[model samples]
Target: MVTVNEAKQLIIANTQLLEKQKCALDEALGRVLAEDVIAPISLPPFRQSSMDGYAIIHTDITQKGTPLTISGESKAGQADLPELKPGSTIRIFTGAPVPVGATAVVMQENTARENGTLTINEYPIPDGKNIRRVGQQIREGAVALGAGSLVSPGAIGFLKGMNMNEVIVHRKPKIGLLVTGDELLKAGDALVPGKIYESNSAMLAAALTNAGASEIEVKYAADDFAATAEALAALIRDNDVVLASGGISVGDYDFVGTALESLGAETIFYKVRQKPGKPLLFGKKDGKLIFALPGNPASSLVCYYEYVLPALRRMTGWSDPFLRALQLPVRYGYSFDGERDEFLKAKIEGSEVVQLDGQESFVIGSFAVADALIYLPVHQNKIEAGELVEVHLLPV
Candidate 1:
């Protein structure tokens, strides 16, 4: 067995970054950028009007009620605009390019137009009041987005505005999931004695998808050693990472460890000093990662979040690839006497975190509503209300 920090360090040290790939900007959402994106052209390439107003020379309007001739109208996307005549104003719409020599724009609400004559209603029209200068948002040949940035919906739109059709990003990892158990039955099947509904496959699959994994293949195997070994070998051969959800413990039916050993896998760590997922096993074979998780549903999911998820993110080139951590106060007092570090399901209520019920490795009721995990160290046995504790915020 190894300490939690030691296990994490080993996983990080052995994990390698995947190769980069070109992805269309439309399909780059949730992907990490492998290179910086430079602006091809300046935003609002020309001086633009920010409001539906009249563009005029500041010197032409000196006081309130000053009248000037209306030359022409300039709408958005219009080219070959009429020239600004001396002592004259031109009607400009929002996003329309302002004509040369126009230094200020007076909003329509602050001006009165009678026939072709425009009168300023508000006095002292300032220069550059409503004009968006050239390159005000971004200049051409400038870095728009830096490398290692996560491409979001807003980022797509921004890149599109810069006329980018594609971006280079770290490719998502291909995963293979193997679920092992003989006493589990698929949902909607007839209930039989000594058998329960199988849920680890569906649960872990959903979690993997939520973490941005796209290429995934799920397979099932019985408790028999031959079947388990065959499934593990196939998954390792086909995917960059393989996750086996059961058969890692010391039970008589467990065969994952022996199967891995038969394949000559390098066991990085077999167990950790943590509650709910102490039997977690991490190993590598032929440059592929393999994790043998605990049989219990809650235990498997916890191991996925704490260990497997970080490895996947790191492989995909994320800079900080762990669950977000914070220090928060507990809503109520609690006590525990255990040598293992405990991760209790919790929900953030206002300013404090409240520990929920049903923390057993086999039960997931509390996990359903949990948005955070309150981590209690082995050295700390008791906590008082309003005491500070370490909290790991879940991605959900």
Candidate 2:
């Protein structure tokens, strides 16, 4: 068995960033950019009004009681006709360009209009206030976004403002999922004695999808070696990574590890020094990565966080491939007669994380409301109610 850190290194070492492709801006969310994006033009492109009010030269308005003649109207998308003269103001709508020689805007709410004239209700106004200047948000020729960063909705909008309709990003990985167990039944199937519903495939698939793997094929293998081998063989073709859950223990029908060896898989590591999920297998066959994970729900999830997520991020060219782990104070008292590194399902209570009750590795209910997991190291026995503990946050 290897330490978790060592196993993580082994898993990440094999990932190669995938090929890049140009995709439409709409489809770029969650994808890591493969190239730097430079702004072609300044954001806003022109000087524009920020309020639905009157635009006037500061010197044109004398006092709160004075009224100015309405010279013209400037609506959004309309060209500026001429400069504003002294003692004159233009009726301007929000987003309309400030007329030339205009230095200030008085919002319509503060200005009372009588016929074509305007009376200011507020006394003094500052020059050049409330205007979103040209290039204020982003300048032309500036590096708008860096490579290896995931594209978000805000990034898409910013790129669109810069007239970028397409971007180059790393292609999402193609994943294959396999589950092994004779005591597992598919949904809608009649429940047999000693049988449980198959859940690893669903959980693993969701995790892979959220990690940015766009394609996934799911399959299941029975306990028998031939059945397991046949199932894995049919699913592994052209896959970037294959994840097989269950059938990795010492039992006779724990066939995944042996069956994979028969298919020529080179094992990376067989186990880690972690509780609930110690039996994990990382390997490669025909240039495709394979993960033989433990069947327990919590174990599978912990393994996914520690190993699989980093690999997927690396394959997608993420600059920071590892998700951030936070160290939060424990709000609930607990004790561990530590023999292995244990991950306990937990929820955040303010800045502190409270470990949930009945956090057995196979129970899924405790994990559903858990927003994080607290790791307890070996050789430790007790944790106080207020002690700081490291927590791996679940993706929301």
Candidate 3:
């Protein structure tokens, strides 16, 4: 067995980042940028009106309630607009390019139009009122997004406005999922006396997808050694990472360790000094990562968030891979005699952390409402209420 920190270090040290790929803006959300996105042109491309008003030279309006002839109209999306005639105003709409020689846009609310004539009810105060100057948002050929940035909705909109159709981003990893157990039954299947519904793959898949992985192939393996070994070898060859749940402990059907050895994979560690997932196993073969996780659903999830998740982020070139950790006071005291570090499913209730009632690995009721994981060290057993503890915030 290894300490939690040592296992985490080993897992991250062996991860290899995937290559970059060009993808359309529509498909770039939530992926990491592999290259800097440079603005091809100025954001607005031209000086634009920020209001549905009239464009005129500031000097053209000498006093309040001034009237000028309406010579032309400039609507958004119109090209090659004629210049604003001297001593006259041009009707303009929001997002419309400012006509040449125009110094300010008078808000329509302050202007009245009648008989092809315009009157400024109130004098505009500023020279560039209600107008967006050229290159106001970004300069031409400027860096719109730096490399290693997480592609978000705002990023997509910004890139689109910058006329970027596609961007280079780190590719999502291809994963192979294998579950081993003879007593497992699929959902909607008839229940048997000695069988339980298979849920680890579904939960793991959902978690992986939420973490930005898209190409996940799920499979099942029986308890037999031949079947388990064949499936493990196949997944290792076909995917960047292979995740197997169950068949790792000392039992008649536990074949994951033996299977990994048969496939020529070197085990970096077989267990961790942590609750819920002490039997977690990590291996590497020809640069491919293999995680043989424990059978319990909670155990698998805990291992995923603590170890496997960081590896996935590393493979995708994320600058920070770990969950958000914070120091918070607890709502109540806690006492434990275990030697392994325990992760308690908990939530933040205002100023303090409250550990959920059901902490057992097989019981997931509390996990449904958990927003954070309360980390309690093995050496320290008793912590009084309001004492500070480290909390790992889950991704919302």
Who wins the lDDT comparison?
1
Higher-ranked by lDDT: 1 or 3: 1
On the 0 to 100 scale, the lDDT of residue 331 in model 1 is 95
Candidate 1 overall lDDT versus native: 0.91
How many residue-pair clashes does candidate 2 contain? 0
lDDT of 3 by residue, 1-396 (tens): 998889989998899889888988898888888898888999788989999999998887878989899989999999989988788999999999999989999989998889998998876557888889888999987888998899999999998887788999777888999999999999899999999999999999999999988899888999999999999988998899999999999998899999999889999999999998999999999889999999988888899999999999989878888988999999999988878888999999998899999899887778889999998888766899999999999977
Model 3 TM-score (2 dp) = 0.90
Clashing pairs for predicted structure model 3, backbone only = none
lDDT (Cα atoms) of all candidates against the true structure: 0.91, 0.85, 0.90
Model 2 local distance difference test score: 0.85
lDDT of 1 by residue, 238-293 (tens): 99999999999999999999999999999999999999899999999999999999
Candidate 2 lDDT, 1-396, residue by residue in tens: 988778888878887888998989988888889999888999778778889998877765668866888999999989846788888888988888888888888898898888888887766788886677888888899889989777999999889877799999888888988888889999999988899999888888888877767789988777889999988887777588888889988998899989889999999899898887999999998778898888998889888987888888888887667657898889977887646788888899887899998677788788879888887877544888889888888877
Model 3 has how many clashing residue pairs?
A: 0
TM agreement with the true structure for every prediction = 0.96, 0.91, 0.90
Ranking by TM-score: 1, 2, 3
